[model samples]
Target: MNRYMWIIVALSISPLSAIALSPEEKGLEIAKEMNRRDDGFGDFTATLEMTLKNKQGEESVRVVRNRTLEVPEDGDKSLIIFENPKVVKGTAFLSFTHKVENDDQWLFLPALKRVKRISSSNKSGSFMGSEFAYEDITSQEVEKYSYRWLRDEDYEGKPAYVVELDPVDPKSGYTRQLVWYDQKEYIPLKVDYYDRKNDLLKTLRYEGYRQYAEKHWRADRMTMINHQTGKETLLNWKEYRFKTGLSDSDFNKNSLKRAR
Candidate 1:
């Protein structure tokens, strides 16, 4: 190759290729890249066993079914229905998440035979009395948070990107979140949530990741531990069925009432 061609090749392979990206720009790029990889599953269904543990270590478990439909221009739409626990049986939650705005959520109570809208201000509240806040359960749209790349580090024996994300919404429960994203898979392995007081509030860890369709990564287990309360929540996911012909109608408020 000629001298010019050699210079082009060297630039392409050099670390300086990324010199133009600021920390914020690099963080957004990473976030968008990860979102792109997770974009095309279309829809999926899964079974989840949620275990809630108190500070004293007492545990209670509930079984639920989850359905999610993709919305390309915005975030995803999801429906979750309780199945096993008698108290929560037939109860359902439906969420429509958006990229630049607050999410729309509703809960259906079988006993009351009514669907109650979840206020935007309540997004920080506990979801079903678990460690996961209502906002935590919603899709983590890239536009929902502003990000800054902290550093690259080793986490769980793997190279990971440490990024800090601050929620754009003033009403959000968390002041910021620090995520450890697996460098290879572009998947989040752990997240530390800070409360409005800027104190560490909860830590969430994702484990047992198994890929599907040769590209999509799904975590079989997710655990969240609350620092102040000493409580925790474990979610065991199973039977993930992707592209199951789910539709937008399957995620509406009426669907919540009709959810099985």
Candidate 2:
């Protein structure tokens, strides 16, 4: 064919000749889409019951109240207050998550009547002796990790996209994480956490999801199981109130002392 005719043929088949995206690019696209779908929440509050189980099957329960404020340009701010279990009553934790920087965290201990700052190196430590680390409690920003799309598979009978995440922060306790996101909702259904030694450490599963504000999906129950330690933590969330007019001041370090 003549050059002009060949050009015309190529244009006609452009759809089939589209360039394939690299795995990294595809993964980032998925993460961005997930973040986009979850944007504009403004603020929210919820009540949670945390159950901690030891290797010997002993269980301890604690009641907690949570408040979050969304920041459009940066990351979210959150506060967690412990209400039950007299030993831990009046304890509070405040977190300020950033899109590209290490999160700021503090804890208020009623006994000592002091607010202690949590260092970046200690973020990997367990939260109140639970299976979840301090870093795991912060708002997950897309910029916090690099991603790679692994594959599409079925999880709990739902179609899911499997993606691997490598934390951008070197201080992170986990080396990497594998997440299974619901294809339709763009929400994570399960996550496998790999320890710094690159061993499978824990698995987190989200269940009983309920929609709020007709757009936001909140998991009513989350269970984290530690494979090596044979420990488990279960969080049951309730009374989710969205757009409740939470302010930045409510999540500040000073607010930790006032948290009830």
Candidate 3:
């Protein structure tokens, strides 16, 4: 070949080599930081609230009394106690998900006496009459989703990375989601959710990132707005702790009834 042809080939590959990380890789790096924190879960407390709306403009709100036992990488076991007039407060919700497919979930109710099984099929059901579905709260481990790097842009005057995520589970409620990660803190600043019909469903915004440790950051408030219904849900993290001595026994079935 000619010298000009070789020079052209070298220039074509140089630009691609300059960028070291992709968008999906950046998002995964941020998520790992969130999992491993230094100061959260030393017996922490938080208040969670969720709102739901229908096509007819009816809204329902649910309050959650939350306590989390942090076990880094092993999954954080949290007991969500309902505070509304509904029959959920006294009941307990327990979940333990490992790196593999051994995710165990149980619901203990005073009415049932014994813990009732929650099948994977019913994962899309509403939680305590809130807009957030059960699958939304339980979390999707990194293995459950595939990612694509979109691009880099400025968000809130800071450099940010944008990525698209598609769930591996066909039964998942979301169709797809686009996420933006702050380049400095490596925290998610915004997320765009798509519905089952492949249309934009909602937009979530994050604000007030307080650095807990060298690599830990806590977003004080997160708000989600439904594009179709014009309804909104807000989550304020009252507190978050890390490195608590939570054990495997704490996530067992017998311990669920004692979750209060």
Best by lDDT: 1
Off by over 4 Å in 2: 1-19
User: Local error of candidate 2 at 15, Å?
Assistant: 16
lDDT per residue for candidate 1 within 1-260, as digits (tens), equals 89999998888755336556788977888898899899898999999999999988899998999999999998899999999778779999888888887778788989989999977568798887899998898888988899999999999799999999999988899899999999988999999999999999999999999998777899999999999999999999999989999998788777788999
Q: Which residue pairs in candidate 2 have backbone atoms (N, alpha carbon, C) closer than 3 angstroms, thus clashing?
A: none
Q: Compute each candidate's TM-score over C-alphas.
A: 0.91, 0.89, 0.76
Candidates arranged by TM-score, highest first = 1, 2, 3
Summed backbone clashes in each candidate are 0, 0, 5
Q: Give the TM-score of candidate 1.
A: 0.91
lDDT string for model 3 (1-260, tens) is 89999998787665334446566665554455434433344444566666566666676767666666655565556666666557556777777654435456777886666787666455557666554566666644566667777888999899987878787767877888888878666677998889899899888898888865345666777777778877777676665554445556766777777776
Candidate 2 local lDDT, 129-156, one digit each (tens) = 8999977877888998999999999998
Highest-TM-score candidate: 1
How many angstroms is residue 232 displaced in model 2 relative to the true structure, after the best TM-score fit? 0.7
lDDT of each: 0.90, 0.89, 0.67
The 10-residue segment of model 1 with minimum total lDDT is 12-21
Put the candidates in lDDT order, highest first: 1, 2, 3
